[model samples]
Target: MASSHPNVVTLHRVFDSPTDPYVYIVLEYCPDGDLFSMVIDSERYLMPPEPYVQDRSRTDGCPVPESPEYVEERVKLDNLIKTVYDQILSAIEYCHSLGLYHRDIKPENILCSADGQRVYLADFGLATGERYSTDFGCGSSFYMSPECQDGAGRRLTQYSTAANDVWSLGIILITLVCARNPWKEAVLTDDTFREYAKNPDFLLDILPISRALNDVLKRVFCIDEEKRCTVSELRASIRGVPRLTASNYETWERLLQRGLLKASRPKEHAQVPVEKNTFSNPDTNSSPSPSPVHSPPNASWDYGPKQGKFGQGLGPFAPTSSDDSWRILEKGRPR
Candidate 1:
């Protein structure tokens, strides 16, 4: 962890203890606590004035109020969400570049500095290599992806990817927007979670929670790998940055209905055989064949959206839309 990421908290020293059966790791601490604390605090401040009862179930005497000001306070709360989401996306993108998957992503794992400006991704104990068989199962039980758990509650073996990390990100987002767990009413299990995930009733025509934020989270938490918001797509969603012409979120809704990931599973799981280059005739006109076959100069990122191209910088966070409608939502802007 320390050797690969320059921005990550460095492991300056390690100590071996014969008295205990483990090696002690020295980590940097944030005295102000972690993102979990902030989330609890944020939730407290964001509790709904009244429960969002459905129209059918709502009583005649009482009605739901307009969406909270926090949702649109661009400068203060909205910008804060954008900044944290951006930083989180950057950290996850960095790990993906190194082929590392943070299987466990929850409020607790993200640490915030005293000023709350710096958010750090911590707790690598459940972190694992991306390209591995995943039925083995590793991650926070509550936030684990639907694909990870089994009837017996064990993680599946033939799985794990950058997509899983995104799944966790979606859950974190739920915590942020709803100010409470969205699936609180459902059973906390694999089947239960998937059932709810497959059908998160956004109350689209019902009004109330507002459409803009709904559009944003739906894209962020998409289940299908193809349709699921890629890192680049997600980075843009932060700050309500709209890259699409329409912001109603229908395309994402269709994604859930079409379920692109399942159809592409076979293609995604098909691994290429790695041939060993034990002995090659280097002098055998290695440069004679000018077929223009090329390899990337760096593993970090591809410069464009082409086949077989790679680039870490191509994230959802990048700016793609016109600035005319998009603005850095400030506190008073909506607050």
Candidate 2:
């Protein structure tokens, strides 16, 4: 999945060893926590103290940041929940744009950044799309899309279109606000999972989400392949809340425009910009690590005070920082 969409998760390095399970993976860590945890700890997240446009603090009473005791909680639960959906939509769209389908799209598997800038769709253990395929279904029965659960009994072909991923995304979106699986009620049999897949609309309508969001889910969660949305279509459809899309052209432009903006930014300020750090050629080194610079959001910061690190990245050895001994401050602390 990282190969397809680097922003999905920052894969630090790929290692291979002749150890048990054949050590082969690119590891990473999420600074914050998963979406489920964020929701479960609802009291901890307050809206900005000031208006959201200019600042990013909580609006209600300007509660202490993440302070369990001072948080204002929210009067309306819908906005925070919608944020989760919005973030997931952004990640899912990035994957789909790469011709990939995150066969897995459940909340537990989705991780949030420490800064809350984005959500990541992790565990591509069973993911597939364009140049990839797996015999196993990637997500829990509760979130499986229709195509992933029907036919030939647990076989991969049962429901394996890009739309299948959208179906699972729909279930996740509903769960964001409702906080429980809606299908849990209708799905009674042992194959309750299968039963849920049998009727997505009936399951969705049960929650009473905003009419606009509901409409988007209606299309993505459609049981029939012909009516359902593919990764690209699903992304464009949900570009705006309460409104699927302004029109086809508008949707494509937004998607394209985002891609253009991301590509145009200077490489280093990628990965959904935090603050920013510039790397001189010396830090690049020999080996092949995808410098933190590849992800796209890094280029938007004021350049200077570039940080240095010991690393061997993708291109031939090159100096990474101006100073011979410069260390990046990781959070705080001189590195």
Candidate 3:
């Protein structure tokens, strides 16, 4: 546990008993809950209550001024995003310095403080020390990098773990501002991601993110892991961003007119289509499909096709069960 880093969850101790088969880990308590809940709450602050409907009858035709309360809430959310994002980046940088890579980076893995002003990066179950790893399809599908997915069945010997972490961070940022995932998975089989692969700017047509943030995501999501933006570059780009979502009513209206931003709120969860049964690998044992774990109200979890032992994949919001090797525990009372 990288407890020295303020943004990383502190690990107090670990207990292993000869009689018991499970190993228990004790971690710092964060009562405010995860970032997914914060994002859901911020959705209202991103836009005004009423849609920006144009009226030609009125002589003084301008968007109504936002209430002072609305302005205050928006400002608070903006500052929170900046603070949490900066802290998360610092935590990742610290981990990378120690020759570690967190394969799972998502809102659910981020814990918040009592005042909602602090965040801690947790769940390093999938983390690895190796810079390059052959563990394909190892993370949440929604936050996975295109190269990591290996949808083409290239049978890649390994992929850069650092690059994969950056890609997942990009997705987390998008969800924070837009309250929706950019795509179901970073693979050609998914229509949204495929469109993005072809046109880097396609996200602008579907999501309500600012151009600056979109530019950052474009670099972060480079198909070539070797060319993807590093954690340092990502921090710089984010600091330069003026706003996460559309800055003004005019910008929001323009996107709406272009059939980009929907009048109603976006769906809480992404609907993934199930694929038909495929031939199982003779070399590996087959198992039943795992039941979709219960997730938070607005949290998104990976339910894509499971890869075989040595197969190439074609395709976290909740505290879902992991493999038998590890488990995390909190010291304080539950939130």
Candidate 4:
């Protein structure tokens, strides 16, 4: 089914090495690499003004126009996000049509073409045919849905895999535009996520995304699986958005002045306490490693156990920054 879809990476062949006891799978090449790299690159070059600067500008009255080069680059990036996201949605929609769900749908699983305009949804190791699954904590910590995390300690019997995929997609879209994850995980243990759970529109206060996109994300991130927007509905909503980034500078200025956008600026070198093995099921004190793959040279995994209300294991995790504990897991999966 994946091979039949143009937006999905085609699997060519599978083989086993008789000597090394290993299996090799060949997949289509994506020259520009995964969407994770694209997002990291965008973060370095396209991030919005610092929080302090925004505050100062607000107090000083009004804001200035963005530089011509910055505006041009932002437009290009927004277009790229829309195109790549639309392709991803189409690929997932196709998978759903076949009664298959890609349980893991982060940026790392999405590969890009030479020009970076085209994208192919890759990595189906976590894909499943079941409409509902008992496999809690089945995806990356950053992108997993609340119900999938079962963070409330309710021990949910099962969750809608399709809805879980949609929730992950919402996080991915926000990351594409803001170059940051709204929170590390969806559980109440994470402060950022806790605030979001309390206020469905919390993202509007922090992310630079437009109000139109926020409305769509609210539906996408709905805690109720049955109430969550479907992939097709999400695709249509995103298409109708005029722009992904905030357009009303004056409104943003006012919000900043009133301290409503206080969380908009990330703390510098702040050590945020994170629950280890928060992804693991509370019922069973076991942490399941997603998959073993090489880590990037610049990154390292920390598997040390840290005691927290959620669990006793810290991570087989890579921390993106001291301030934001967003983990990009198993990015080097063979393809």
TM-score of each: 0.55, 0.51, 0.69, 0.71
How much lDDT does each candidate structure score?
A: 0.46, 0.46, 0.64, 0.66
Model 4, 1-335: lDDT tens per residue?
67779999988898877886889988898888887766664342244432112222233323345566766776776776788789999999999999999999987788888566788998888899999999888877778899998644455799999999999999888766655567767887877677778889777655556778888999998877889999999999998887677744634454656654434222444332222323332345554333222111111112122211112232221132112222323343222
Give a tens-digit lDDT track for model 1, residues 233-331.
Answer: 777666564321111223223333544212211123333222211111122324223212111111111112111111112221111111112212211
Clashes of each: 29, 26, 1, 0
Tell me how candidate 4 scores on lDDT.
Answer: 0.66
- The regions of model 1 sitting more than 4 angstroms off are 2-7, 17-22, 41-74, 150-157, 184-209, 241-335
On TM-score, the leading prediction is 4
Q: RMSD in angstroms, candidate 2?
A: 21.3
- Tell me, by lDDT, which candidate is best: 4
Models sorted by lDDT, best on top: 4, 3, 1, 2
Worst 10 residues of 2 by lDDT: 47-56
Write the number of the candidate with greater lDDT, choosing between 2 and 3. 3
